[model samples]
Target: MASKRPQSPPISLVELRKRCRDASLSEQELTDYFLPDEENSKPFAPALKLNEALVDVGRARPGPDAISKLYADATRAQTPLPKKPRVLTQTFRRAAKTKLLAEGDSWFNLPDYIYPKTAIDFLGSDNDFDVSNIALWGDELEAMVRAKQYRQPLRSGLFGHFLFSGGGNDVLGSIPAYVKPRKSGDTDPAHAADYVKATFPQKISQMMGFYRSLANDARDATAGRVVLYVHGYANAIPKKGGHYLGGPFETLGFDPVAHAPLCRAIVAQMVKLFNDALQSFAQSTAHVVYNDLRPAMTERDWYRDEIHPNESGARKIARIFAESVRANTPGV
Candidate 1:
């Protein structure tokens, strides 16, 4: 008889490592995982030391689940802004027959006032549509799937649509490391385009793989009746290396004045690269639709920062998403 293949790990060690990097794990949990049980066995000494150091600095807390719970609570608190009067609303309304499930990063988790209507809000607004959003801030494409953030919601029931917003955080988080110092009078667009062409292939392939896996999972869970909607980001113009909500990216070591133009270039290039990948993915996959919100978003003054959208901006993107769904899905 042939030997059985090695069993896979029950939980994603990668996700666990990501949690540790984010400081989402408690001191005790880190100690239990990294340290030897009886002091005789080998331990991950560096991680133990780091854990101890974090505790000393009051960064490590008591409960292992506390930080994760806090994150979930924060995400849940992002309620939709009260519906504006007819004059303020610009998007067409269509009642939906299907439930909506959303997963991604801060684009979906940031408060409605700040990031505005997530795609789910648009799909669920007019119909008896139940919505479940499991998006978390700072989430990357692979991390969300590896952690099963999308899977948990699928268990609730059969959803008619799965709206995904990701890949932006992954690019934004990595690009600064790759951006080169600009030569005097170097055009921002050219430099940005070059950086994207050089870096996007590998990242795009990785993102495509994650999306493929997600598509497979959704098909299994929903019997191929669910529609997957992937979106592209709008161009962002950052005046400085700081987030809109608060927090400075100055610690990342870029000169705010010298690098600001390059940052804008990167944002524009990132949107194009992501949208291109999304369009290609949609072409290859069944029931996957790519919604290009960039055109509508670019013309409006909806951005909160370089990457996130304000409430008005969110409404515009949501409107586009809703219209796309109404047009694409049969019997919706």
Candidate 2:
């Protein structure tokens, strides 16, 4: 019998940790550690929400009427924006049909099928069918396939999917400032500030862009609603977590010269970016969720360095997001 192989999460956050521990990486350097090397990588799961809503990308097809409705819905969504999901007024079923054919058998390989539409259309609200207004945004089905691929490896069935790889952050440096120290942690605030100022925004922006791509991809592929759940900062994992991983953001207390309000300000910026960038997906019933993690972050449990969390801590954050989407989100 073939030996049973161990599987990895769509995101092997643990593997990311190990690589970081052995090496001293810059914010950008550590980020590269998490990205997908699709050519040599194994398959895994797509992001969480994708698996639930749009499961089968290849075999699924929308009826002709559904395509028209999606266009109409998109139109009304862009204009004065529909506060609720009402029927769209204007529609063009014939032209919509012609556009779908442009993709040929699968449109799977087209880049346009998965990027933001610059803006969402509200005029074609009457289009309740599957096709989008211009057939630009497309992903849900493809996302699911990609997500599963990332969860593991290709041989195991998850290699080509989209993976979360934001050029890494300065967690090694930041965790100490906001978090109280354990034993004798590094009291270097400037190091933390540098991490926050230099690295945080880039990662947040990168992640948001990834989500936008997926959202468009979902619309094109499934012609349905998309949602985002905000899973923000947590209390540190006591000690060693940040130090162990070597990220710059791991809290190390305040340093007189290098420290500033950079950590607080950067986290604030991340929240704004997630909210404002995502707000454009209006018209479509997308939602953003926020919450303070349970078991609360503590100064002690954050690894030995007073930053980063053990698997347990990371789970709490992931859970807030995972549970909310499961609980809310209509017909998801």
Candidate 3:
């Protein structure tokens, strides 16, 4: 007989430890065992969250040696910026270029999708930006702000460019909660704005507050040297096949196929609200720059599912960020 597959929760602590030590265990298997799918849970479980099973197994955190090994690749082979013009002061002649750091949702964290690619990965390859990314899959904007995983990396003014990709997961996750029901006599909304509930603006406002606070923290931590690069998602046409949100839509009586127009309208509204808030916030905040990704990705760029861009789409988005880097920073 074959050994039974390990289950998620409800498994014995002994089993959890055994699996953790098992070199053959794949990342997905470990993730599922540690962070099981819960009903109505957020699309992606917090990848970095501590689990009790591991705690009981005596592995509280990555040991220092492990941590060092993990980040070695990212820290190595960084290209230093060229010296400033001779006209500049001798003290500031050859200050190192600001390091790049990234934090946020799956857009920055998803590396194991069908094609082993992500926007951040593309940015590194296409733009030669050496970024130490701490983004986690399924992380919402509020969660990312509260997590503060970037704090340690942002210190010492080492990281000058803080690339962020958030708000998309937050808005997508909240769609079922705030989307208004289609009225009996309603026609397909002419504008995307018409599809959302009256409270959606307030919801967006609250999310903006999270973004603002996060930006402030990043800036303050680096003593205003770090320039934040915030990006918003493209207007993706809604469809039936995503990891999350599909069931909620059907439950609300909106079929992605039959109600394509309405679904797209809602997605548009969400995207607009998120992007507008980010752009406005960047305009007001010092050292904060917004990269509008709406034009970079089209339906063709996305995977078969409603959310997530394919490899080509990821490359296109990375090109936009490369432009932003060139415009803002020098000697890359």
lDDT of 3 at 328: 83
Best candidate, lDDT-wise?
3
- TM-score of every candidate: 0.65, 0.32, 0.72
In Å, residue 51's CA in model 3 sits off its true spot by 20
Candidate 3: tens digits of C-alpha lDDT, residues 1-332: 99987654544445544544443445544444343223323543322222455335353454323322222222221223333324547676455333578887777765242233678877766435566677755667887788887776787456778888877756766667777666554547575466577787888798889888988899779888888899878777666744455556666677777777777778877888888988999899898989988788877898654567788888888888878876888653
lDDT of 1: 0.58
Whole-model lDDT, model 3: 0.65
Across 156-257, the per-residue lDDT of candidate 2 in tens digits comes to 211111112111122222333323332244443344333333445564455555545544544344333333233333323222222322233334433322
Sort every candidate by TM-score, greatest first: 3, 1, 2
After TM-score superposition, the amount by which residue 178's alpha carbon in candidate 3 deviates from its true location, in angstroms, is: 1.2
Residue clash pairs of candidate 3: none
Candidate 1 ranges with C-alpha deviation above 4 Å: 1-68, 74-97, 111-124, 155-157, 243-263, 299-303
Q: Give the 10-residue window scoring lowest on summed lDDT in candidate 3.
A: 69-78
lDDT: worst 10-residue window of model 1: 40-49
Please report, in order, the local distance difference test score of every candidate based on alpha carbons: 0.58, 0.30, 0.65
